[model samples]
Target: MLRIADKTFNSRLLLGSGKFASPQLMQQAVAASNCQLVTLALKRLELDKPQDDLLSPLKAMNVQLLPNTSGAKTAKEAVFAAELAREALQTHWLKLEIHPDARYLMPDPIETLLAAEQLVKRGFVVLPYCSADPVLCKRLEQVGCAAVMPLGAAIGSNQGLQTRAMLEIIIEQATVPVIIDAGLGAPSHAAAAMELGAAAVLVNTAIASSDNPVAMAHAFALAVEAGHSAFTAGLAHHNNQAIASSPFTDFLAAL
Candidate 1:
C-alpha cells in the first residue's frame, strides 16, 4: 500500500495506454493489469474537440490518469501541455518529459529538471522521465517530484533494462519512489526489475504491442506481484561456498 500524493496503490506496477490496437482492447488490458495508474501521451490527444475519443475510453477504465508531455521539446512547452492535460482530464498528475533532440528520443536533463520544478510548484504531481544519470535524478528529487522515472532503454526499442546498473543506483539512492520507465519488452524484465527493488515500472510498448494484450496484461500483473514479493521477502544472496544440503555439523559428528 504505497501512497503517492493522495492516491493509494496496492500494485506498484504502472501501465501506459499506448500502441494498443483498439480502445476496447486497451480497456480489457487495463482491467487485467490491475494497475491503478496509467500514462497517456499528451501528443496523441486532440483536446480541441468538445468530446475526446481517447480520453473518454480511458476515463471509463477508472484508473488514475497520468498525462505525459511526450512531444514537448522545451520546459515552457511541457508546462503548457501539462496544464492542458489537467484541464481536459481534470487531474494534476503529470509525467514530465522534454526532449529537444528527437533522434534518440532521449530526455533533456536540464529541461526535465526545470520543468519538474515548475510543475511541482504548480500543484501537479510531477514524475519526470530522465536518463539513467544518478545526479540528474537527485536534482529532480530536490525539486520535490513525486517520483523519478528513468528509462531502461530507448523508448519503444524493446531492448529492455539497458540501464540496469544505473537503475540500481537510482533505486538505492532515491528518497521518493524510483519507477523504471521504457524499453521493457516482457513480463520477465518487469519481474527482474521488481526483484532489484525498484518501487515500480512504467510499461507501455511491451504490453500494448503484445499479440494477446489481455493475457499479456495478466502476465505482467502476476510477474510484478512475484517480483515485489521476492523483494519484500529479501532474496538470499549467492555464496561462493558449495555447502551441502545435509546438516554439516551433524554429519561431521556422525563421521
Candidate 2:
C-alpha cells in the first residue's frame, strides 16, 4: 500500500484525466486501472459548461480528486489556483504546477518552492510537481509537503524516466512519498519506476492516447503491482561471474 499524508492507497498508479476522447472513455480507463487517486487540471475543466460534467463522473467512481494548478506561472498564481480549487472541488489536496514557459512547460523551481512553503502554511496538502532534483525534493520535504512529485521527463512528453539517476537520488533521500510523475509512456516504464522504489507513478498522455485506453490502463496497473512486488521481494544485483542455480556436487559424484 502507498501512504501519502493521511490517506493510504491500494493502487500505486495515478491516472490523469486528459487527452481522452471523452469523459466516458476517461472513466473507463480509470476504472480499468483501478486507481484510487485521479488527477484533474483546474484549467482544463469547463466549469461554466454544465454539459461537461467532469467532476460528476469522477465522483461516481468514489476516487479521491487531486486538483492541479497546471497553468500557474508563479507562487502567487499557484496559491490562488489552489484556493479556488479547494472551494470548487471541496478537497484540500492540491497538485502545484507552476510552469512559466509554454513551449517546454518546465517547472520553475524557485516559484515552486516559494508556492509550496506558502501552501503548506495555509493548511493544504501540497504535492509539488517539480524537477528531478534531489536537493529540491529535500527542501520541499523540510517545508511540510505531503509528497514530492518529481518529473521523470517533460510533462506529457512520454519520454519515460530520462532522469533515472536523479530520481533514484530523490527516492533515497525523501522521507515523504516519492511519486514519479510525468513522461512515463508505457507500462514497462511505470514498472521500472516502481522497481526503483518509487511510492507511485502518475501517468497521463501515454495511457489516454493509446489505441485502447482501457487495455493500456490495465497493463499499467499490472506493471505497477508487479514492480512493487519485485521491490518488496528484493531484487538481485548484477554480477560479472555466473553462479550455478543448482548444486553440481551430486551430479559430479554420480558421473
Candidate 3:
C-alpha cells in the first residue's frame, strides 16, 4: 500500500481522464488501467444542469477524483478554481497545474508554490505539477504537499523521460511521493522510471492518445506492476565486464 498523506492507494499507476475519444472509452481505459486515482479537469462542469452521468461511471468503478486546475492563469485564479473544483467534484484532493505558457503547458513554479501553500492551509490535498528541479520539489514538499509531480519532459511530447537526470535528483531528495508525470509515451518508459524508484507515475496522453486506449491501459498496468516488482526484488548491479566467480583476479592464488 502506497500512502499519500492520509490516503493509501493500491495501484501505483495514476490515470488521467483527458484527451479520450469518448467518456465510455475513458471508463473502459480506467477499468483496464486498474487505476484507483483519476485526474479530472474542472472546466467541463455545468453548474445548473450538472451532468453527473460522466462522473457516475467512474464513481461506479470506485475511483477517487483528483480535480485539476488545468487552465488557471494566476495563483489567485488557481486558488479560486480549486474552491470551485471542490464544490463541483466534491473533493479537496486537487492536482494543481498553473501553466502561464500555453505552447508546452509547462507549469509555472512560482504560481504553483503559492497555490500549494494556500491549498494545504485550506484543508486540501494538494499535488503540484512542476519541472523536474530538486530545489522546486523541496520547496513544495516543505509546504505540506501530498506529492510532487515532476515532468519527465514536455507535456504530450512523447519524448519518454528527457528530464531523467533531474527527475532522479528530485526523487532522491523528495520527502513526499515523486510521481514522474508527462512525457511518458510508452509503458516501457513508465517501467524504466519505476525501476529508478519513482513512487508512482501519472499517465494520460500515452493512454488516451493511443490507437486503442483500453488495450494500451492494460499494457501500461502490466508494465508498471512488472517494474515495481523488479524494484522490490533488487535488480542486479551493472558492471562493465563479467567478473570471474573464482579467485582468478588474485595473483597469489593464480597457478
Output the number of the lDDT-best candidate.
2
lDDT of each: 0.88, 0.93, 0.91
Segments in model 3 whose C-alpha atoms lie over 4 Å from true places: 44-52, 243-255
Give the C-alpha miss distance for residue 138 in model 3, angstroms.
0.5
Question: Over the stretch 1-255, how does candidate 1's per-residue lDDT look in tens digits?
Answer: 757767789988798888899878888898899888988876553668664376666667677888899889999999999999899688899999998887789999988998999999999999998999999999999999998999999888888889999998988898988888988889999898899888888888888999998899999989988998999999998989996887666656766
Put down candidate 2 lDDT per residue, 4-38, tens digits, no spaces.
99999999999999899998999999999999999
Across 91-203, the per-residue lDDT of candidate 3 in tens digits comes to 99999989989898899999899999999999999999998889999999999999999999888888888998988899888889999899999999999889888999999
Q: Give, for candidate 2, the lowest lDDT window spanning 10 residues.
A: 42-51
Question: What's model 1's overall lDDT?
Answer: 0.88
Minimal lDDT window, size 10, model 3: 43-52
In model 2, the clashing pairs are none
What range of 10 consecutive residues in model 1 has the weakest lDDT sum?
A: 43-52
Q: Cα miss at 166, model 1 (Å)? A: 1.3
